[model samples]
Target: MIETAAREQRSAEPVVRPVRPRKLGKVPFVELADGRLQGVVSSGSDLARVYVSSISAATHGFSCSTNNNRPCGGLSGGSPCKHLRALADEAVLQYGLDRVTRYLRVEAGDDDDLMSRLDGTREAAPAAGVFSRFLRHLAYLELPGSTAPIAEMHWFPAVSAEVR
Candidate 1:
């Protein structure tokens, strides 16, 4: 059923990025939790956790890593790799114009209201079952990385059922 469909989607090859940045697809389903914007993108048959952190003092800007425990090729050595950029583009698209415009006005800083809401969400525990798993998977991004945290002002209405 749902598991089979998700597996099928995961098995599909990752969308090839053009030589230059271009719209690849809609933001792969994402969530704002624990003061981070998190999403899992399939790289070939592997799952990579991609995230933007909201903590101002953190070291890195963004990071991506696969389920197999490999750092994203782009994120290694603190580079702004294509994978990270694609994920950000997707997130902005998902966030929409109104939010992006506001995010821009704030200089993508932590002071934005949207960031505050998401950061505050950390105080409230994530729901049980699916949400917990989704949080766990996304939480992997918090491991040592090159980026600082930034709140995800745009809230995803509901958790994606894709978490297994």
Candidate 2:
């Protein structure tokens, strides 16, 4: 039976115990009205890597202008933020690693486009203008390896100016 095969598959892998959802904190996910799911993964070490990689690719030569902006400077807190945690959780729950890898590729493409645009326009824009543009661009990025917006979640402020 298909169920037996699925059980066997699950058993063969190292158990990735379902983390308590609350442990993901502010990372958010949505259950659609039709029972489909969509949202950003915002937690876990692997997920953090995905997000950091995406941000780095997107803003290659740019310094973050916002004092509160943490993405470009690296995860500023002791650990990955809730946004990254939620994104990772959703990826695992829905598509697994294969899909997650594909999603990251797509996100990287988007970041490349943004970087191209920024490169084209940076000469004409002021620093603040560029920063604002970056934020606006970020708003439109579908969370890498996800089809949904990085859920609107509050991330804890970086604990110190020293980048981790």
Candidate 3:
């Protein structure tokens, strides 16, 4: 694992790489962490609700539910719900297709669709963990912009200090 201090001590020069960005409307939050591709996906039916969906990296086990713990009706045994698919697609955008492919241990040719290649089963997993993480991330966005170091972030490296 990369340590915050170690990362902070690196060279000041910016390292350039191919950039990829995604619209936040569909799947606002996506991540490849905790051994799964998980995120909060907007609900198509209800404007007030968002679904938390996840696909396991090992077995591609799937689950989707509202933040309120209501299961998504679309998650049948044969396939993952649209929210899960959206989450995976957004993950690929956030983390390159190659990274995601390697993380999930999926083998696919360049021309193949990512989801179509996955053979997954409907797994009854809890949504609380994923949803709570999403909420915590949102909380950071609400914090007032400040250069002052936060006490809670003592371990975080201030790489921005190197810019100027």
Positional deviation of residue 82's Cα in model 3 after best superposition, in angstroms: 1.2
Query: Can you write out model 2's per-residue Cα lDDT over 23-57, one digit (the tens) per residue?
Result: 33333332211111223333345433222211122
Q: Which candidate has the highest lDDT of all?
A: 3
Give the candidate number with the greatest TM-score: 3
Off by over 4 Å in 3: 1-19, 149-164
Task: List the candidate 2 regions with Cα displacement exceeding 4 Å.
Answer: 1-74, 106-164
The digit string of per-residue lDDT tens for model 1 on 1-164 reads: 54354534653422322122335333343443444445545454333433222211122234455533445565445544454445445555565434443433333543443332221211111123223455577688787764664444222223332333
TM-score of 3: 0.77
Q: Model 1: runs farther than 4 Å from truth?
A: 1-27, 44-60, 97-164
lDDT of each: 0.40, 0.32, 0.81
Which rank order by lDDT, best down to worst? 3, 1, 2
lDDT of 2: 0.32
What value does the lDDT take at residue 73 in candidate 2? Answer: 32
Q: What CA root-mean-square deviation does each model show from the true structure?
A: 17.7, 17.3, 6.1
Model 2 lDDT, residue 163, Cα:
24
